[model samples]
Target: MNYQWYPGHMTKARRMMQENIKLIDLIIEVVDARIPLSSRNPDIDELGKNKARMILLNKSDLADERENEKWQEYFTQKGFHVVKMNAKSGAGVKNVLPVIMEACKEKIERDKQRGIKNRPIRAMVVGIPNVGKSTFINAFAGKACAKTGNKPGVTKGKQWIRINKNVELLDTPGILWPKFEDQSVGAKLAMIGSMNDQILNLEELSLELLGYLHKCYEGILAQRYELEESEDRLAMLSAVAKNRNCLKKGNELDYAKASNILLEEFRNGKIGRITLEQA
Candidate 1:
């Protein structure tokens, strides 16, 4: 299967970010805890080069707990103030303000010396689609300030929201680069439902997902579907189909229904707290 990310309005989003970067003092980047590095757009590093940076590992609740800690350490070692959070439930939300203050402490001190007081820190929130940028903003602000959906490209334009008297947020649409340098990254993004499902070949994608789960997380399928052992990924998917009662008119397995179930369960953490990559 070819893992292609349709660019959509990403080019325009990049332009908007470039135009607004200078007006920003800090960047609050959100990434999926399951695919931290893959979910990150490389353009952000260039766009936010001179600014203070923070990495919010959104949806950390759905990822492997041990891996989440490692990801926090990994990003911290690279000079980003990191927070592991679940934006939907607002878990770990309270930790954000203190860390934001710490990340922008230098700028705050500089402003104090320049006779500026109570100047809110302007931060640009960024991430690839479906990494939960809008949800994070809503949770952080304790209100529905930005629109959020399960799939990608929900946010279409920029919105500036005051998170507090000390910090304000600039919300930008999620953007992915035109081409994925590693096709695996694209595949991972697709598995996480970051891409539009209408254009994808779900059966092929489910097979790939089955292969990964059988390798990295053995017994997961057996436990979830109560299936006997099968080395073949397609066979495992068939078992999922039978277990899910996804049968067609002729009693043949509905691979498409099984595929959707597998992918959706994986995304929603029903398969377990699994991480796609290691730090």
Candidate 2:
């Protein structure tokens, strides 16, 4: 699918991030563990060029365990301090504090050298829409400091959350890049609910998701829907509709209803701990 979603607020958020990046010592970038590379905004590297970087693989509870390990290694090799976490449940959230200090060790040491002591480390949480940035902030801060939502564009402005005496967090609104040149990246993001659902064709999106799952994770559909898989994704979807009783007024299969069920179950990990992309 040809996918492009750049709302006006996201443009304003990007500009705000560019302006605020200079004030923070570290960039705590949150990415979906299921599609780490696709969920990242490429412009962040340019905007946060000189700052210390930390990659949080948020919502890791829904991703493949082995893939999470691989992604952690991948980012760590690229000079980023990585942490895999489920922000909603606060799993692995404790590890983030020490990792933040470690990531900004140089800056901390510089402050000590310049006789600027007892200053908290400044950090900013950033990510693409629906990547769990707000949830991570609330979990890491051990309070409901930032607003949390499942949909994209919940955070409209920036808020500085002081976590403790030693740390402070700047929470910014989720931002998407101006455009997606790679269709695969856009598809992956859409599959993971990073895009606005109102603008998408759910049936088409579910079909694409089924195609990927059938290829990479065999037997998942059969196990979940209790139907024999087929080479044709639409046929499999039809079977899913029949088994799930997704019928219309005339007792005909409701493909759209079935599609919504499939996408919702997959997103909530009821289908399985599946990862759409690999490191």
Candidate 3:
């Protein structure tokens, strides 16, 4: 399935980000741990150019541990203050403040030299849709200042949240580009629940996911559904439908139901700690 989702509100969101980018001192970008690169909006890099960058690898618990480490190193090498965090459970959330200080160290030093004391770091939190920007904000602030949802497009507008005396956060809506240059990036984003599921073909998407799991994580489906593993993705999905009793009124295997189950399980990490993209 060809994946593309750019809601009309995103244009306004992009404009808002551009207008506010100049006022921010640091760019605190949240990205999905399972698909770090794909979950990022390329526009953020341009918008945050020459700004202090801190990357929170949100939902780290759902991603492959080894791959998460590799991605951390990758972003670190690229000069991002990286932290692995599961925002839902607040795991590794305590590390954010210190790293924020670290990322904006020069600014703090300059402020101190100018006799400016306790100048709070102004950070713009950005990410692609459903990458946990609001959840991270809530976790970092230790309060629910923004709305949180399992689906994408939760934050409709920007909200300034005072995190602490040391930090003030500008929380913006998650933004995707006008078009994906590489469709694979779109597909990966869709699989991670960044795209609207209502507009997607789940069965086709599931086949693609099944193909990957069978190739990289063989025997996982068999273990989860108690069915024989197969190189054929369609056969495996069918088996999953039958084994899980996903059926229509006439006892026909319901591939749609099976597809939703598989995607939901994978998205929730019930299948395993799998990374759609490797660093």
lDDT score for residue 61 of model 3: 99
RMSD to the native, candidate 1? 0.9
The regions of model 3 sitting more than 4 angstroms off are none
Badly placed stretches (over 4 Å) of model 1 are none
Error of 2 at 191 (Å): 1.2
List per-prediction Cα lDDT, in the order shown.
Answer: 0.93, 0.92, 0.93
Model 2 clashing residue pairs (backbone) = none
**Number of clashing residue pairs, candidate 3:** 0
**lDDT, model 2:** 0.92
lDDT (10s digit) by residue, model 2, range 52-164 = 99999998999999999999999999999999999999999999999999998899999999999999999989999999999988888888988989999899999999999
Least lDDT summed over 10 consecutive residues: which range in candidate 3? Answer: 222-231
TM-score of each: 0.98, 0.98, 0.98
Angstrom error of the Cα, residue 151, model 2: value is 0.9
lDDT at 197, model 3: 96
CA RMSD, predictions in order: 0.9, 0.8, 0.9
